[model samples]
Target chain A: MSENIKNWLLFILTVAVVILLSYLANSIINRKAESQFAYTPQIEIGAHEPRNVVWGKNFPRQYESFMRTRDTSFATYLNGSKLRDALGEDPRLVVLWAGYGFSKDYNQPRGHAYAIEDIHNTLRTGGPTGPGTGPMPSTCWTCKSPDVPRTMAEKGIGEFYKGKWADKGSEVVNPIGCADCHNPETMSLQISRPALVEAYENMGKDIKDATHQEMRSLVCAQCHVEYYFDKNIAGQEGVPYLTFPWKYGTTVEDMEKYYDQMEFADWTHPLSKAPMLKAQHPGYELFTTGVHSQRGVSCADCHMPYQSEGGQKFTDHHIRSPLDNVANSCQVCHREESGALINDVFQRQKKIKQTQLSLEELLIRAHIEAQKAWQLGATEAQMKSILMDIRHAQWRWDYSVASHGGTFHSPVEASRIVSTATEIAQEARVKLARLLGQLGFSGEVAYPDISTKAKAQAFIGLDMDKLNDEKETFLKDLVPVWKKEAAEREAQMPIRPVSSRE
Target chain B: MRFSSLKKKLLPPPQWRRPVIILLGIGAGLAIYIAHIANVGSYLTDDPTACVNCHVMTPQFITWRHSSHREVATCNDCHVPQDNFIKKYFFKAKDGLYHSTIFTLRKEPQAIVMHEAGQEAVQSNCIRCHISQVTDPRTAAGVSNHAENRLDRTCWSCHRNVPHGRERSLSSVGFHLEPLPVATRKGSFVPAWLDAQVNHTSN
Candidate 1:
């Protein structure tokens, strides 16, 4: 009714409206921040904190989920976290790797959680009491643990590599975790391995300048790429320094050229007497050629999709074969039916296996022929070209096979590598025949009887009894010591819990 | 004359004015509330149901039902979120909203891109649950080492087939036969007799 009353009411109404709007906006902003910063540091995470539980106090979801890599139930068509004895299914491998430790025991890879256990259980790393006593170098544990980076930092990189695997067993206990790839302060992906950084450096590139999209796959490349130990680095002598043979390039041909230039050989073939190169798993390199990668799909895109629970969301920490979860891994990118996507993977694998097996048979024959030539007193000059051919052929074969999941990861490239291997092997056999004929021997070189794994071992002249006996002795005698030492060391590490009220 | 003129000049307000104002207020409130609810709902159901929403995933769902991890895990259990709650939630909210919106619109991603981050997430969850009970010392160690080095190495490095075994058919697990045992239209189980008959006839 009065002018003053009307003005007072309007002022109050305006204030109420402004207050409500501000509260709503603030709520929205707070929720966004909470989702990103829910994990407050309960206790200060040391730079070298190897244990994930320590990190768990601050980030429970990640730590709890990261711990799940131990599940062995999910299996895919081509890849999963379960261990399968590959040599048992195909005994031809024993003959192929006759002089190598792999022929003794080789199982399909499992989840990252089993990295430490698998290495310890393998007979390849012989039992030893101290440094330099075991068959395997300390570099063997490099890819298995985050403790590796911590150890490398404490002891200079070269010094860490200058010993046997058994010497560091007590120190490297934790499995792969966050510290391996993420910057603790920013939670952004970071390269922790020096080898990857150094490899980039050799190419005149800076890792810090890598694009964000590249970091997704680059993180996996930290461990999954092909690598070898270079004991001849100028100042790194006497140390089996881990290195990627990427000086020439990242392609199969590039790596082959680099290895050839260095005259690098993993081991001399027992039967063929050829200098050989072993291709470590090159999952990243092969994946780069896949349709998905071509489409700019990072490994993190399909394998680590987002998840929600209890009004909160988080990244699922489980990593295994993509076939295990096609809907999440492939369906996100491919419109094809689940069956169709799986069929695509299987088809690629089947086709690749066809060529791979053919190459294997050819390689077996080549090795036998080379041995026969050497037995006939062939000179190094006479066997030179044949040996080189054998080396190149096996390298190609190993490149395709050792790049685990390469068929599904990059079917076209895998097929090409296998075809190349078949051609090289065939050429080697032709050369071997000529050399044998010149030595006054003729006709086909009789293939060895390697129908069974046991028969193959006998053919290789491996004292199975002695080897097995030694493996058993090492496990029984040395494994317990490593465990005890590890327990004591872990006990010494400080673990401060967060104050609940805080 | 004056009282009669005043009464005639006074007119009642139109009946629709007050009702119209009330109706407009209610309609505006309903529109705003609906928009808010829709935004929140989109994030929850987006990709969460994408795997099962499609008919193609039906058979796989059946297999997943019989899977050992069925009780404790879901599709997301093995596929998304490699590590960290903050990162996980950010991803889920962002991707969930995107997927939910796209899936709701009946659009799915073409050419699935395998994410190492997603695989690492699934692998981490697997080791967390199963590592302690692992009987094999070597396997246990590998599991431990992998967990510690989660950023560098994946769990699939050693435990290659823990989830689904190899790609081979169940028959490849030693159940060899000419064909999978099937039920006839008469609801009778196909026996070894039928299997042999089919094989012999084909040969």
Candidate 2:
């Protein structure tokens, strides 16, 4: 080749490379700008802002999505945003919880938007006409709203958990919102609740070192996980403080060991007279054992996936079942057809449900047989081991069932838990049968007619009519007043406009 | 018309031109060959292929490939420090020596874990990238987070999946790379620059 031709080619090549470099640089700058949107604040959001309507002005997309939690149209095979009376579906729950408040009523929670409303409606919270009147402690308000953090910060964490459920009625009006899991100033995921922080401290772990991705799940863990009212916290005695029993560890057996060591009992079964343990929803603990969590999927990854609106991307706040929006939740990683994925979840759930039902049947029979033994004048010594078995079996049953979505979150673990409970229940029934035979009672101590929720409640000796009447009056009289007082307080803390200040 | 006349008056002498071109050709050829042999191109991009550059990392790579993080992050984004280039490469070299020595000695257990230094790197990187999450003014005094013990725990204490899947083992992952029930295990070691050569549509 000629030297002149070679020189020309080199010059052309250099110019081409220069052009490519500039294009690449321009795109890099553009991409950076794209990711970091020019976030012009409309208002200065306070660190403890509880009213989501105030936060809504700053982030319309997220607020809008959060507001979508109000939608009750969606339903899955078992549960969803839609309301389904849990006791109606499964009357056995009433008999299982016999002496507990859950026997009065058990309604499936609608969604986050109805947190405050649902608490007022549910019979479990009981009918309190005013402060210091309800069966539950003020700690029950811990997970219902952003108002909880605000009240806790304002009137000390311990003080916030000091009284009855009605004590903070007027103070905490807002439902679960932005502030419950976010630092309003930075909009970063923050642990607003003291219980989760205290729980971590008890376990010799710190919450601050949790990564953003971990925070995604941990925020939900704050409310969704199993917790108990510890009336024996040092220096804060008799407060019924909301506390996670993770001191021993997070496993069902580990928590059982902790409760057993402490000799804690939620309530004594009236018929069987066995000390019982009620399992609160342990969604986070069960979820941790699942395959998705092990592979680094956060709660938000599935429940609140990143959604794009127009040109902007934000985490969808309308948290509900993955089945409701299979395209966003399941199809994000799963290449399988949506139907197949839904079927897979349903299949696991159905199999777990089968074992759960078997355990419940065994438990009911054991409880009735124990009652017959008591009627036959059996001594406490005779029934001690049998009651312990009942307690153990019921704990396993409640643990398996109370871990919401246990079947899908970690199917093998959920199924394992239920099967173990079945075995325990069977063991309890076998003991009960032996005890009954010795007490001069014969085969099959006539199972109580608990076919319907009403029948179950009646058998359990719960006057639903009186309970409903009291709840109705409280809702009609006190709830409106609570709303009014909350409104007056919120009105005083108006959001200051940033642009208007200038 | 402009460059040829200007080159004649200025620039390199004709005798030196051939040697310069020859040297440039050999240098380019040698650089490309080294990069090809060392798989250096894979290191530059956010591909999992660079992770399995050593055979010991194959299990880790496969698990990560199937992870939800498979889309958002590369190996270095979590496993290496992100503060500055000097510190990053420095940390990498130091950590690499320890890693190479261990793997060379076949010291990795069935379950691989991050060393203290690696853990520090990962924790700092997590906070660095997730600055928005950790930048809570409420935690300024650390009073809310129990003051002295704020950073005593690491992210992976709860987030085991960030390192690798808890269930998957070296023996569990086969060489065939077939689709598994856990994760699809769909990814490649090919760098973005050479993507066209392999028709690499997926990242």
lDDT of each: 0.70, 0.77
Q: Which digits, one per residue and each the tens of the lDDT, describe model 1 over residues A139-182?
A: 98888888877787677677778888878878888888877765
TM-scores of all predicted structures: 0.66, 0.69
- Docking class for model 1 is incorrect
Output the lDDT of residue A187, model 1.
Answer: 51
List residue ranges in candidate 1 displaced over 4 A: A1-41, A498-502, B1-203
Clashing pairs in 2: none
* Candidate 1 C-alpha error for residue A48, in Å: 1.4
Please list the residue runs of candidate 2 whose C-alpha ends up more than 4 Å from where it truly belongs after superposition. Answer: A1-37, A500-502, B1-203
Candidate 1 residues B82-127, lDDT tens each?
A: 4666766676676555654554444544323336556666767776
Query: Clashes per prediction?
Result: 107, 0
- Tens-place lDDT per residue, model 2, B1-203, is 99999988665788888877875676566556544544556665545566665555656665665455665777888888887888878877787667745654557686676678887887888877776655665665556663334467776667664536555444544332222211222112111211222111110
Best model number under lDDT: 2
